[model samples]
Target: MNEAIERSNPEFPPKIINGCVWKLREKSPGMVNKPSRGVFQLLKYRN
Candidate 1:
């Protein structure tokens, strides 16, 4: 999921930080700032 977004937008963060991943949504006309969205996941990484 993260990989797909990253592939589409290089600016996307690779992994969640502090249990959350922040992203900017597309801006519309008359919008003062871009909306931000967060994806939280308790991911277990295996090495």
Candidate 2:
């Protein structure tokens, strides 16, 4: 994820990946093991 973000814009680094889910269950769809960062979050970027 960091690699992709870096490739997108090296100079402009407003976007960042805070947390991620390691795995998920097959029974539950669209559901992660636990809460993840950057999800359902909206914040203003500072200069």
Candidate 3:
């Protein structure tokens, strides 16, 4: 995850994924995940 973020934006710091909240270094970027159903929902929402 960190690698991917870094690839896109090297300035992006490491982020910790805990449920819906995501912590990036010293900053909290708010909710990173959303409620979903099964594989169809997952495929429907691809970032």
Which structure among the candidates has the greatest lDDT?
1
In candidate 3, list every pair of residues with a backbone clash: none
Q: Candidate 2 at 8: error in angstroms?
A: 0.3
Candidate 1 deviant stretches above 4 angstroms: 16-47
Model 3 lDDT vs. the true structure?
0.38
Lowest summed lDDT across 10 adjacent residues in model 2 is found at: 38-47
Per-residue lDDT for 14-45 in model 2, tens only? 34332222222233444423235423212232
Global Cα RMSD, each model: 13.0, 11.6, 8.3
The TM-score of predicted model 1 comes to: 0.28
> Candidate 2, which segments miss by more than 4 Å at Cα?
12-47
Candidate closer to the true structure by lDDT (higher is better), 1 or 3: 1
lDDT tens digits, residues 1-47, model 1? 45566678787556652223333223222332323244323223211
TM-score of each: 0.28, 0.26, 0.28
Residues 1-47, model 3: lDDT tens digits: 43555677766444532322233322432423334421112224457
Determine which window of 10 residues in candidate 3 has minimal summed lDDT.
17-26
